[model samples]
Target: MNHAIDSITDGTTYRTGNPEATWRHMRAHAPVHWHEPGLFPGFWSLTRYDEVKAVLRDAETFSSASGILLRPLAQGEDPGSDRTLALSAPARHSALRGAIAQWFAPRNLRLLGEHLDGVAKAVVGDALAAGHVDFVTDVAAGLPVEVVCAFLDIPVADRPDIVAWTTDAFCAGSAEERSLAHLQILDYFGELAEERRARPGDDLVSVLARVRFQGALLPMEDVVLNCDNLLVGGTENVRLAMSGGMLALLEHPAQWAALREDFAHTAPTAVDEILRWTSSATHVMRRATRDVVLGGRQVRAGDRVVCWLASANRDAAHFPDPDTFDVRRTPNRHLALGAGPHYCVGTQLAKLEITAVLREFFTQVGEVAPAGTPERLESIVVNGLRSLPLHLTPRTG
Candidate 1:
């Protein structure tokens, strides 16, 4: 089939700079529309918050069985994979969710808090010293990778390689490039897994190697897939979330000032608000298992649905003023971390990260404002600032 590809419809190509205007246009006219980009079959872009929630919450009707990205990921998945857990629906997703759930709980990461604090302090301090710095690099992007490193017990110094592999593997700009990055990452992981087997360490990988589920320790391939999931789901998205939170603060000075005044209670709310405002990850893809009606539109059994968290977060029907960046926005049930069985595993870690970064930021710098308008992440799956330049006014001592 010659897909009706309006190549320019891709948000990554042109929407990288100003997503709001693009989303606004999407909501206004083509809210549940499709546009092929020659790479894959087009999909329905669900624009309203209720509509997205309807899909995510009701996984049976709108399933992730087809996977999330625009194009089909190569079927090179190692047989014993937690990705089987992640990409499967119903029974498989439930089992996978239960297996990984306790691993990322607050109680599980209790021993990790102190090291995380130190990491946040180091990055925030570096940014402060630079006088002016890219928040994405100095703080946001830097912190999560370290935290993931902490979780995996990888050396802090290995961040460049870890971040790079993930960037290439998951953040590649196109289907063909992503396909290539996938093979490379899987190869790198194969080596890493072999090394961990020979010389084990005190990290998630070692623990995962030992952890049992459904009568036995998971297969080595599952171990690798889980690590890949942690690599993809944990690092950059949280970095972008924190960066987006900072950008929200920069754009809404009142919210920023409020958070500065009361760091304890206010910082957490700011995290939720940022999720509401930014939607760092723009969309998650799902396949329709059966025919259904969403927002009054009939969806065929095999249809692909792109749940636009970007559009959903700003749906006026759900959020009052829908467009305002209100840090204290209450009843904020945004789809930032998604919902149901596949909700993010690193939620607590992410919250702690945003809180820690904001604490160090407000305490040390006093004032932080954007040096330029936000630039979006150049991928459809994740939304973030490619470079968030911020000028932090020094605290009067």
Candidate 2:
């Protein structure tokens, strides 16, 4: 059967196409539909909540060793496929994730929150003081990179280039540009890893440089690749989520008022709702390790399967009024950060960043209105805003 949507593999389709409508139609008619090869490889698309959750949970059945994005790998292989955390097999993935998990753990976040609160105040205050600002670049993009760089202990002098390289690595216009950016990041981290080896600090790169896996220190290649992983993942997800959440609030005035009225009480649920509404990490791909029947369709061994997290977050069967932007949404078990073992390592950090900024916005800003057209990123992998201009009015006594 012909799907109503344009090719999901094409980046331009995400920039211009109406994917939400198509995802809705597919959820009802074809939850486990297959797309013939087009711009990328052929793959099974899962749109429903249950199906997507199940695939993410059973990583042994649906492996991440093939790579996560929909992009075609060179010669059908990724060099970091089973070595890096995001693309590793379950056994090694556990060890790799455990090495740096302490930094993102609850105790660490509690200490980190104090600093992030201050950062949030400064970031939001600057935007409010500006009167009118591009929320995407001026407000949303600043905090996540700062937090991530702090974890990596990146020097203040080097951050500008790091931020630019990260943007190119994930959202560049061409494949060559993205690859070049990746190489630059890997090289930068490689040099940093060498320094950390000689004189380890308390930062994440130092931990990676010193940590052992399988009774041996991790290889320099894994150290550098994981650093690239942390940088890209840490920066992109929260940046897009913040921008999308702000746009959602601007569009829904009543919800905004409700949040601003009692931010302390409302912030927790609001952050989750924002995550669900934004669904920044759009989809994750896995390769089937065994033939299995899913959603009344047979998936063969080695076939690629793409689970649309954005679509699952909006599946009507799980979420009541799935499309509505409600801030106080409870029992919201959205798959925005994913599910099961491969759940986002930076889940707590993402929440803290969103909550920090929103809290300051609610307390300090009396009004926020869209000032211009919002430009979205042209990528199927990330639901992101390139620019969101907004007019802000600071609260006055």
When summed lDDT is taken over every stretch of 10 residues in candidate 2, the lowest stretch is 1-10
Model 2 scores a C-alpha lDDT of 0.88
Write model 1 residue lDDT over 1-397, tens digit each, in one string: 1121232235555344555666666666666666543355757777767777878888888777657656533443234322445576686666666655676887877877887788788888888888788777667877787777767777656667776666656445676876776666567666666677768776676665655666676677767776777776787778788887777776677877888887787777778888777677777878898888876677888888888787788888778898788777787888888887677778888888888888787778877666877666666667777677888776778
Instruction: Write one digit per residue (lDDT tens) for candidate 2, span 1-397.
Output: 2646545556666777877888898899989998887766789999999999999999999999869878764356766787788898888888888888899999999998889999899999999989999887788877888899999999999998898887677657688998899899999999999999899999999998987877998889888988888888888899899989989988898998898888889889999999999999999999999999999999999999999999999999999999998999988999999997889999999999999998888878887788989988888889878788899999888
List all candidate RMSDs to the true structure: 4.0, 1.9
Task: Quickly count the clashes in candidate 1.
Answer: 1
Alpha carbon lDDT at 264, candidate 2: 87
Give each model a TM-score.
0.84, 0.94
